[model samples]
Target: MQAASFTGILKAIFYMIAFYYIFRFLAKLFLPLLVKKVVEKAGQKFQQQQQHSQENPWNKTTAKDEVIYNTANTKNPRETKKVGEYVDYEEID
Candidate 1:
């Protein structure tokens, strides 16, 4: 069996550090582009939804479809009823 050597351990550490820096560099270059594309797609979807809402017929209100509620003739249904008599108790210390 071949025992681990100092050079082999150093080579492994170097490879790990190189891989980390390379990944960081690539992410810095491409991450913004990926995020920009996502944001633009979301903005387009939001604009489409706004346009759809504006063009919908049910969202428009007209004079004939207006509703008015008369509250003056309404009766109050929440008349309070007594359930039990209150009993006061003195604290004995």
Candidate 2:
């Protein structure tokens, strides 16, 4: 009876460890899907802002999403912001 209980407990522990790794693998796989959703939402927001600006021609607000991104590799800090037809300066103290 004791041997049977020990075997059952060992099986249960093995199953628990397997389940934990499976969960981690699934989460890693779905991470890109989550990122894609976020990027799509950002694009929609940018489009709405563009349409609103078109309706109000007098508004001089710049489009934040006009920037293009290369998902390959980009590490330059300045590359994050779009270099539009205007100047943006930050004071360095």
Candidate 3:
């Protein structure tokens, strides 16, 4: 490959600096709008959840039922279901 001249090196440095500043300027201009949109979406979701929880008492009860069911089933369920069987093994050398 041919050697890079001083002018070529200076042009490359100038192009890199130009791109860096352009990126920084664009980010500064758009980052706030992006953050605002995300915050608005989260706020809307929070309000929806609040409205749902307020409207549906059964929804809250179902969540509690799930917690209770999980804990109760692991220990002593009302209707027992066999999951697995114990096996006895002997090793000989």
Candidate 4:
């Protein structure tokens, strides 16, 4: 096995720096295109969802289909119950 040399270390560092710069350049060129396509796809999906909601039968209601709840005829379920006797307490300061 060969021992590690200063030249070898320098070469490895150079390669690492070169790789980092190249990766950054490629990412700068491609990342925006990828992001734009993803955003467009998401926007299309959102538009499709909006269209689907607009076209949905359940979302449409006519005046005759409206429901009116008569709360005046219904008795209150939570009537006042006498759980305990009221106590009058006087505090002296």
In the range 1-93, model 3's lDDT, one tens digit per residue, is 999999999999999999999999999999999999999999999999999878986545443454344575678657777999999999998
Please count the clashing residue pairs in each candidate, in the order shown: 0, 0, 0, 0
How do the residues 1-93 of candidate 2 rate in per-residue lDDT, one tens digit apiece? 345688899999999999999999999999899999999999999999999988888746577537578965655445566667777999999
Which scores higher on TM-score, 1 or 2? 1
Candidate ranking under TM-score, highest first, comes to 4, 1, 3, 2
lDDT against the true structure, each candidate? 0.92, 0.87, 0.89, 0.93
Candidate 3, residue 49: CA error in Å? 1.1
**Could you give candidate 4's per-residue lDDT for residues 1-93 as a string of tens digits?**
999999999999999999999999999999999999999999999999999988896857676766799896587666787899989999999
- Candidate 2 weakest lDDT stretch, 10 residues: 72-81
Candidate 4 lDDT score at position 85: 97
lDDT of 2: 0.87
lDDT of 4 at 79: 73
- Displacement of residue 67 (Cα, Å) in model 3 is 16
Write the residue-wise lDDT of candidate 1 on 41-80 in tens digits: 9999999999998889675766677678877657655668
For each candidate in turn, the TM-score is 0.63, 0.46, 0.58, 0.63
Candidate 1 residue 93 Cα shift, in angstroms, is: 4.5
Candidate maximizing lDDT: 4
